[model samples]
Target: MLHLRAVCPAERTEAALDVLRRHAGATHLVLLRGAAVEPPGDLVEADVAREATDEILAALCELGIDRDGGVTLEVIDTSLSDHADRAEEAAPGDGSDAIVWEELISRTGEESKPSWTFQAFLTIACLLAAVGIATDSPVTIVGAMVVGPEFGPLAAIAVGLVARRWDLVKRAAVALGIGFPVAMAVTAVFALAGAFTGLFDRAAVFGDQHQVDFIYDLSAYSLIVAMLAGAAGVLSLTSAKSAALVGVFISVTTVPAAGYAALASVLGEWDRAGKSLLQLLINLIGIVAAAALVLLIRRRGATDGVTTRPLSSG
Candidate 1:
């Protein structure tokens, strides 16, 4: 279930209330007259099933409640009311299968920006992966993968393309195009410093580091794993099975490959660096393609009543 709260203008209150009252999955509706001080209107609240959230949001949007007034939705972890259960059951589809577009947009929108925090995490993950590569430590590599924050922008790109949100696509593209290069450059500088301090192992870069060779050895397997991971990642986001996202994190080698490329370049292993970059590109391409396909399928299969509009619609 989801908790929905909307402030509606005095003139539009009835329309918004009707939207909630007519929906089987929108229950426990409350309307407080002149309750909104800021917008100076009525306050409307309801418990909406996950399956019906998209429809309700779309309806409210069409009435311009989200613009003149305001609308907010939050997850309801538990609902003791039998009314809640009935609401969920009455909904056309299972909650887990629902795609709440507003939620997804809010979640990925900020991630599309190449914030300092995103750059920091990516650089840190790459540096950690570089250490793991030098020591041939699978455990450290896994940790680095979990720490990497590259998936957000990748997901944003997928969602943007499917939802026809070109601004999102542009922002995500800038994040990836700028963030990766910046991370790799920082990682390379750090690797150079480590080599000067005799902390980085040149032998690992030049010799047979078979344990970490998979990071650079791009193959059909890399593409397959990346696609699977990408699908699972988007599924996790849509279904609210966020824990599954961790598995997706460790399954792709984008960060590790970047780290490997950075260290190899600093070590003058140009061939190894080239191969690592190829591996990164392969994983990125596969992930974006798979994720876009999944979102496209979900959008196509959406219920007729459920429609998605950009947060800022034209």
Candidate 2:
């Protein structure tokens, strides 16, 4: 369920009330006239089923409430009232499966930005992966994968393509294009310094490190794993079940591959670097393809009025 609050202009209050009254998914409606100070409007509040949020928000936007006033949505973690349960039952679809496009888009937009924090995380993850490759440590590689922030922009790219938001697509592309190469370059320098100081063994990077070799080893399984992880990552984002995202992070080899490529380049292993780059490309393509497909299918389902169940029972 979601708690929706809208500051409606005096002239549009009736229209907003009608929308809530006519929707079966809305309950616990409250209206306070002349309650908004900033916008100098009436305050309207309602508890709405999650599945119906898209339609409600659209109607409010159509009424120009977003421009003239404000609309805020907050998840209702626990609703102890029977009215809330009845509202959910009255709604057309499952709350968990609901694709609240407004929420999703807003979230991805902020996350995909090329912020300093994003760069720091990406660079640190790459550095960790470089060390992991040099020492042939699977644990360090997994840690780097979990810390990598590359998935945000990647997911944003998929969402943008499905939503046909070229602006978002361009922003995400710039973030990834600049982020990956910068991270790789920084890690390369770090690896070179470590090797010179005798702290990192350049030979171990090319040795039979069975545990970490998969970072540069491209195969059918790499594609399969990336595809699955991409789908899971999208599902986690849409459903607000973020714990599943950690699993997605550890399952793909994107960060590891980038780290290995940097290490290989610093060690003058051009062939190994090429292979690692290929692995990186393979994972990126597979993940983007899978995530875009998932978003497109969900958007189509919503358009066709197909109700979807949540991935897990709350």
My TM-score estimates for the predictions, one after another, are 0.96, 0.94
Candidate 2: worst 10 consecutive residues by lDDT?
A: 305-314
- Tell how far residue 208 is off in model 2, in angstroms: 3.0
Per-model clash counts, in order, read 0, 0
Q: Rate the local accuracy (lDDT) of all candidates.
A: 0.89, 0.87
**How accurate locally is residue 269 in candidate 1, as Cα lDDT from 0 to 100?**
91
Superpose all Cα atoms of candidate 1 onto the true structure and report the RMSD in Å to 1 decimal. 2.0
Candidate 1: which pairs clash? none
CA lDDT of 281 in candidate 2?
A: 92
Q: Where does candidate 2 stray beyond 4 Å?
A: 303-314
Report per-prediction Cα RMSD to one decimal.
2.0, 4.8
Candidate 2, residues 115-167, lDDT tens digits: the string is 78998999999999988887778999999999999888889888877877666
lDDT value for candidate 2?
0.87
